[model samples]
Target: MLWGRIYFGVQAAAGAAWWIAVAVSPFVREVTLGGLDPVAVAAADIPLFVVGSALAASGVRPAVWVATGWTLVVAIALAVYATVTTEAGWGALVMATAAVASVLALCLVLTGRVPTAWLIAGPFSFRPALPRRIAAAHLVSTGAQIVVFWGFFLVVVPLVITSLENRWSVTLPFPSFVPVVGAVVLVLASGLGLWSGVTMSVVGNGTPLPAAMANRLVIAGPYRFIRNPMAVAGFLQGAAVGLLLSSWLVVAYGVLGAVLWNHAIRPHEEADLEKRFGDDFRRYRDTVRCWVPAISR
Candidate 1:
């Protein structure tokens, strides 16, 4: 576990230190590589890296070796780029992070500890242990979610507003990168969505998909506080994207989508759940709020 511990530990520390260095710098907003901001990139990445580091540190699997190695490479590349391009520089903290990450990567890789399957699959393959059919289904469902919801609805449509003349559509102007307000919303919603997916797999013994729904009831994680955490996350994500892009039409679509789900889709899904789960579903549903979280529940 020496390779896993020291290597991934450096990666985790580097990710954190880079963020800190960027945040405290005078040109915080100017810390972009291309057109993309590192905050958003870090927001997506830090969680996965942290999880990988934790697993590696605990010697859970050899997957962390690959994760750490890849992360180290990325950190080094970014550091090199920052050193070359920026006038302000990455500072002493980030320089130390880069140095440590490089050394760790060499140590992990040179020792022949990196697993091939982990390189091919990932540091954390969610469906690798599942049956082929289940894995395929999960991939299809996840692909649809990324393509339809995240790529098309959240990104493409919102970006369209940039070319238009009118700035306002029908948006409520919510969930922007405005201080901690939007960050908090994004973090909570993303956490809930991830929690629901993980809960479906673990507690319910299946992936989160209507077509291949969980066989058993999943009352763990966010499901303990709210019945439909994924839906809540979806709504928040959509709204956040709209607000971030200054597109009222996108926000309107989000609000309308929520309404449709509540009125049209929810009842049918609930009925199906009731049929499948019987009194257990009823009791849980009765205790848990559909939209809002009751933290104590």
Candidate 2:
């Protein structure tokens, strides 16, 4: 029952992310055009919308990857064109927003790849009784993510961009195809983060924590590279958001988020796992660096 709820929650969140991206992309383009017709701009996105919808419905890994890759490629190309040809006013802002929105949309497609078995298996299959403190922590962490990413990164940073444009003078140098390159990187990073988070959440809830909580670690997919790929990916996404908006404050906030996540949240979660998993947990911890990628044992 708990697993079902978690699965649905993840699905709902993923869907919302994609739809929000779709809605926002046009708005950003409109801002760039300065009240020009949005129909032409939006028409270009029809293929992306159709592909994304198909991936969601089919849930095939190859289709998801192909759709996501195409979206990223096209978005990046558009961003490059905008950067090179358009002036550095509302047009730049619009292009940057579009890039970020495309990245977020890619994330949604990646999230759909989370395995179905994880959703079907009840939480109790892993933990007969979830500790109250751990459950509370997970809830709080998820809530914090929503608030920080949506409220601060998305809303506040855009407002800051507007304020800076209106009040402060700023200049950014872009290489010939840098905008497109940056767009591609942003999409890939965001997609990886989304995939990692969805997978980790399933592992966190599905795996039986070691009595010491150290040994029952997941070592597949992105986890093969890093102990906390999800968190690292999230940090990257946040940094990209800061860069896209050209806001140092947002960047600082992203840094602060990483610190808080590592120091406060990760520790508690680790302790819970250790208590649950025991010596096996220690073995896994010893083999894996918390965030850095290492050669798998």
Local distance difference test values of all predictions, in order: 0.60, 0.51
- Per-model TM against the reference: 0.48, 0.41
lDDT of 2 by residue, 1-297 (tens): 233223323433543464456467865444444343446655654445444435433554464444445556655554444445442245444334444444444444455322323322443122422433354444444445545565665567656654555432234443555445545656777677655544444445332221212123566667766667667766766665656655554555567678867864566566656777788777778878887788644
lDDT per residue, candidate 1, 1-297, as tens digits?
Answer: 376466666566665665676568646535334334667866755665655555555554554654556556656655455444442222322333444554445455446443223322332222222433354455555546545556666677667643321321112444445535545666777777776776766666566656556667889888888899888888887776655555555566678779767865677678778988899999998899998899877
Model 2 lowest lDDT segment of ten: 206-215
Which ten-residue region of model 1 has the weakest summed lDDT?
162-171
Give the poorly placed runs of model 2, Cα more than 4 Å off: 1-182, 201-216, 295-297
Report residue 269 deviation for candidate 2 (angstroms): 2.3
Q: After superposition, how far is residue 114 of candidate 2 from its true place, in Å?
A: 37
Highest TM-score scorer: 1
